[model samples]
Target: MDKLLSLCMIVRNEEKVLARCLDSVQGFVDEIIVVDTGSTDGTKEIAGRYTDHVYDFTWINDFAVAKNEAVRRATSKWILVLDADEYLDPSEKNDLRSFLTGLDAGQPLGISVPIYNCVESVTSGKFIESSAIRLFSNLPTVYFDRPIHEQVVYRDGELPLRSYPLSIFHTGYLDTVRKEKEKSSRNLNIFKDLKGLEEYDYFTLGNEHAILKDYKKALYYYERALTKKTESMTIFPYCRYQIVLVLIEMKRYKEALQYIEDNLKRWPQYPDYYSMKASVYVNLGFEEEAIELYTTALTKADAPAGKDKRFWLITPSLGSHIPLMNLAKLHQKAHDFQKTVYYLSKLVTMNVNDHLVLFQLLNILVPNESVASVLNFLGKIFDFGRADHLVKLLHVSLLLGNKELCEHFHQACVKQNIEMLAQQQLLYALVFNEPDRFERHLPEAGSGSSTGPLNKLIFLAAIVWKREDFSSYLSPSQDESDPSLELLQSMFATLFHPEEVGVDLPFDVNYISTLLIDLFKMGYYDSYDWLIQQYPQYYFILANILGDYFYQNNHLQLAVDYYSLLLDQKQLSGPGYYHLALLYLYQGETAEGLQFLRSAIELCSHESHWYIRYLKHSPATEEKKEIARQYRDRFYPYVQINVVEQLLKGQA
Candidate 1:
């Protein structure tokens, strides 16, 4: 009488966890039938410790077939199917031992066991228990089918399988959700190749699609799966979630509200349902309502049992950062700086690596003269290697006019060979009213040859405009034909006047222009005049900068002069005319501004239509009444205003 139970398992590369799993059940089961389906790890060697029934089977695409093969190889009266990442807790092992002891003398079928799935928490790095069903009967009366989400199908002609309280601890799908996603994708491709995939196949495909973030396709498949008339409400709620997610992605917030309301009507305790509702409210700019929903989600998070009630469901993970960050932004947008600072501070505590949170914190905290507090908080939580944090610290120091702190951070950046640090250092020098300090580092701007062209431009822009005199660096042969010169030209072209180019440049040209414009806008008249006279061909690049600087700094007369110079230039182009129109309107010369705007409309043949609309609606020009009529009659005939209107609406 072979008084034994054979443990069956199908495995691949499970070397990292196979030993632990086998050890957990080795005492309860007599013979372990470890079925290897092309495992390239030390899994076979590790499996040898518990049993000698290890055998190899060629992998077919169908997992059900592989599992069935494993069941057939067992020689004992009872068989237990397990995975390489699954284990039996001590209590579960004792339960199984007791069940086996009391097994009917002639019993051939097995019992279903409860499974507790544990996932590693992304925030705390701890494991939380979820639930599933892993234990099942080994008798031919019960079989599994389906290519991907294989279900245990019981044959119609046998005693009903018994379910026990014995629970399996599943670590297989823990941090490996990403890997399971890949497996699902592979299964999807296989199902797609088949002649006709059933409704179940569509559900599995939808699950894979949802995991991959292809929400529209996921919704399509889910809707199709729903149409199959399945009675399983378990899959229905998940499908609804996927549909809501798709609507969210599509930015159909108003439509998604109905779905959320319907979902809550049925499953009121679902945490993710609340999270989705909150997300929709956030998109619709209902910040107060969104916050309320999120608060409600926090209360209901722990209501669900099993796999759905993990840390991700209860406490916010990295996924929840966006909503919290948005709420902070909303406070900032509403001019509630204190609330903005408070929320940003909370976000920084959650994850210090989030540069956006650090930026927002600096933006709010520095304006309120709370730089020291922010710096101290950041120092406590963040490691020093984060370049973005260092940059933000330097920015905050500059904002507070603390040259000593700025210099300290600048040195740290230099020591770390962070190229952006050089740019930040230059900005720090300029902001603190110390141009000489920036000039001292000018020669070393391009010293790091490996630094990208964009970084070098930032360095050069800082030095050239910040220095007291522009004529000192003049050379007859400035290597104007060099690739670096072209890059510089392209950078300026896209930055100040994007209408001149058909496509946007791949670097931060606006930042470089901003730095240069700031120097001229701060009453550096000599430098601005000298650069304009020397680089007349590049004058259009300086026009917007000059106009913006003067307009912002209350030097409207100087802004008028720059705008006039831009209008006089033959290479002023379409955007140049628009800027000139804006400046004239700003200077109370509405009629002249309207004429310049009309000229811009004529030049709009090669420019984006949005620029034309901008010119038409510009209050800075006096000719809007006439230009509006002219725009309707003359330019509207050639321009695709409908498409341009849509693009304008999108921006608004």
Candidate 2:
């Protein structure tokens, strides 16, 4: 077959990801030409496995020079430029072939492939997408430009380019990779040493400085970029946005607000500006203005492309999800439950795959709504027939300790005949408090290299569960042991094994939370007070979990301990107070109980059934009746809800 596309890449010390990148485009690209600029690793050898057209080049501080060297060696109609850290989506290889075949290669055409730069883990779906002209015709007139932040250009002028439906995932931007490679420092040095810096060059410098947390330098360069000829730069808006972001990072929200407002006038069609302005308003304590601006942002953020070529939509979510999230949080803080759910639910619909969105929605719904109502809401939003949705529901339900809902999701998963992953099995076992299921999946689930800390926590759970002979599940050493797990181990030793070490908790919130739930499950009331005393900081975080768990389970004394702690720390919610009040009332602590109930009624919803419940728990006093009547305008709605029977037909 005559070569239609050639893959050109310049690399050094990319042995870890080189083969994977090459492997992705193996049969798709007609030829592969890898230019090695002094790799001290197996990069050359790995490139050799995929192609014979490997060439060596002397290391220059110039990326363009190396890239042009690689491009000069290509012998094909089209050039597909890639970095060693980037790869085409293997499934989309056919689309690339079709795209190349259909294009008129003789024209000054270039395809701007969206490069998804992974910020954290490449597999973690955390990435930023920027369109780059990575695929272009291999004409003699075409070559690379710039020493750093290089781009392909015609010898005469810029090439005509358009966005395409193809993806290239890059991992070089990841924190681990950035730290190891020090690429930011290299780029910064290149920009610093460049003789005649341009607008784009200044922007690149801003980016590098921002990445290094040198905000002062970043803003200086970004301001310099704006002072240059930015009329043709597609990254102008990005540079502006970066300045705002950096200002936000530096807590200069007022200054950031000025910039955002100025940018909005110049680029009013841009939704991200509105979103950024909203954020500034939030920081400036203009909550209502912030909400209104966010709502405005939502209406305009759905443009399929940038308003003009001089802009790029660098942020994926600033348009919709970001504003939605901000609105949800704002409303939540305002104690407007309905508005919070409304925004979060909208977010849920938009981002079906976003676990955090769905989790927040669940958190809002689960506490306020009935189980059946929550189930219906889930059904409306998610197709539980899908294994992924079911799995998410199951995970969140487990987190919420809603075992009945977990069981429902689990059964639905089984009906779909989905074989649970090891982690899923562990989650299931953990939430359901199923020791046998935990035993069944522990080995495979515990064996992962990165799961050592989690596995140790699981090992501690096994101890709590009194799993016989779980020594095999323990990792060989505590080399990877979490301090949280050790704290748990110490707590266990102090309580059950009195001859062992005393509790010296370097308190870990997550593990302590897990311990509370586990102890609550075990009905080990003795452990509760000890946990509370050992970790005074628990009042802020874990105390609620402790209070809710004990309260919901009707563990009177344990509930009293945590709820009282919450009260002492001023951490108790109205619902929390209601639970504690009930506990105290049941225990004949009448004075404190009545006072707590009154406070609950005062702080909680006007529509709260607690008003009616307060009325019922009487050896009725005039004061209690008067309080209820005064606060609650009508008992009719409440009594209506509580009644199970219909009025006799035609009785009225």
Candidate 3:
């Protein structure tokens, strides 16, 4: 006789995905046991289609109790526990059947199947695989443990377990599903009643709070877990990792570093601790130290024969790939271009589908190559990914003066039927600077209006062309073109007569910056002045572009006004301060200029060549020279100020 298997599950309002889970195992399982705990939806009706063993259970707010109740009704020799959102792959059905049939009839055993928890990220989707003992012999002693995040265990029987390559795809963690379920809040409420039961329970509480972004609360519970004196804790490493992560989230770098240092002797082989230490070092501006720590992490992670060869779920990839990425960033920060490329190339091989990495590679490589080489490289590497990413590639193609490549990409866009109206508008208005091309992609006359990517692009193009009839093209009548265009009419109203429009609506700083740059390029001073005059608060974006534009065109007073407004906005750090300082010096405001110049050097000493040069030329008393020396010493350790000083002297 063939061995029988019963599918046992407890569900509530899982009507949406019930059919899918049931159909995957309908042919294999002998009996289907679904215990509904008060479902108002078509869950019961759907379960009825699968099997007659559907039973209703009372709500106890205890997952283990409900799960155990479902399993108790199973009559088969073997039991398979599953959730509503989880299912075995259809392709693995035959293999699962074969494995179950081949099991020893005399043995009391279970199989640890891999559960691939699928989650969709901004760019792509990936699975986080974990092991769970879902299949077991139907013994009365074998049952689930805990109220939430429950696990399968046996009471008195020694259920020997073996691993299987079989996987169950889990969708409960998906953002779309989780928003409706709010599982973390539910779990948190359930955990409130079950606190102080075990050290592992404290860890789960920390995880729940961490998901809710309550890092302070999370840290408190994590510390509580650490305080628990257990002889041998399996989750101790994970607990340490979580504590460090929470500290980092709070930006308590000093506390985090001290914790890592204190624990280094105890958990020497854990790569994530080292990774956390490197992060703290980076935040503190200790670049060299960060690089060394990141390197050490990579070494430990890749070691073939290490004493502690265990991997934990909390930071599965920290030891493997994140270290390399961090190392790459540190090299990039230190301006070590070749080393940056080397690490990034390694990352590319590891994550071939990473468009951001591919884009970064192009950014670094394109500047050093000729137009033909860049075009050839783009053609060889550019695979159709996100539309926004492909748009950026087109912009890069235009920057390299490869019109043919741009046209090729345009043809590809048309072939793929990808709607990239914003990109096409940018290509015309910004890259090609052709009014004809800009006008070609405008929305049809009868199409209704709303604020969207395409409509925003249209507004940008209209301003660039200085089209007299642009308002007619952007009719306020709500006919029907783009849904997101309604909020942007205030921005567009200020286009022709900015002084007349109020600054109640918010406009994208980036979009405004691009528009300001274009208007400055085209010498449309009236329109540019109107825009800045209307929205005085968002002057940071306008001021930077206008200040530089006017400074380059020798409009010193106007440039000073724009730059001074930027300074007034508390934006006087790094490049903004440096440029404002130079402008003040040009206008002969020596005292005011020197203060701004000092701020620039203090913020980023690596780019302090000109500031140092100006200080050297100015009349400097002993006290002023000492102050200058202090500023230079504080910010310019990595910068070759002496080399810059010598070069300036030689020029003089």
Tens-digit lDDT string for candidate 3 (171-191): 887867887789889998898
Candidate 1 clashes between residue pairs 3 or more apart in a chain or in different chains: 131-307, 585-620, 590-621, 590-622
Clashing pairs in 3: 448-479, 448-480, 448-481, 450-485, 451-484, 451-485, 451-486, 452-484, 452-485
Lowest summed-lDDT stretch of 10 residues in model 3?
Answer: 643-652
Best candidate according to TM-score: 2
Point out where model 2 deviates above 4 Å.
Answer: 13-28, 38-58, 87-129, 156-171, 302-313, 368-372, 459-463, 466-510, 517-652
Estimate TM-scores for all models: 0.49, 0.74, 0.67
Better of 1 and 3 by lDDT: 3
* Alpha-carbon deviation at 204 in model 3, angstroms: 0.7
What TM-score would you give candidate 3 relative to the actual structure?
0.67
Ranking by TM-score: 2, 3, 1
Backbone N/Cα/C clashes per model = 4, 0, 9
User: Mind giving the per-residue lDDT tens digits that candidate 2 earns over 1-652?
Assistant: 2689999999999999998899888767989999999999998998999899999999879999999998888889899999988888888878778978998888877788778887756544556667789998998788888888897888778788887877888898887788889999988777767888878788888888998999999999998998656856777767878899999988676577778878889878757788887876565445666889988777776554453532225555667668888999877654566898899898888767777777678766765678888999889989977888887787777655567777788788889887777766776676656778877777787666656545544644554565535644554334433553445455444434554543454456665676666554434445444555556644567777766765554355676776777788788778778876765666677677777888887786563346544554544567665755553354333223212012111112
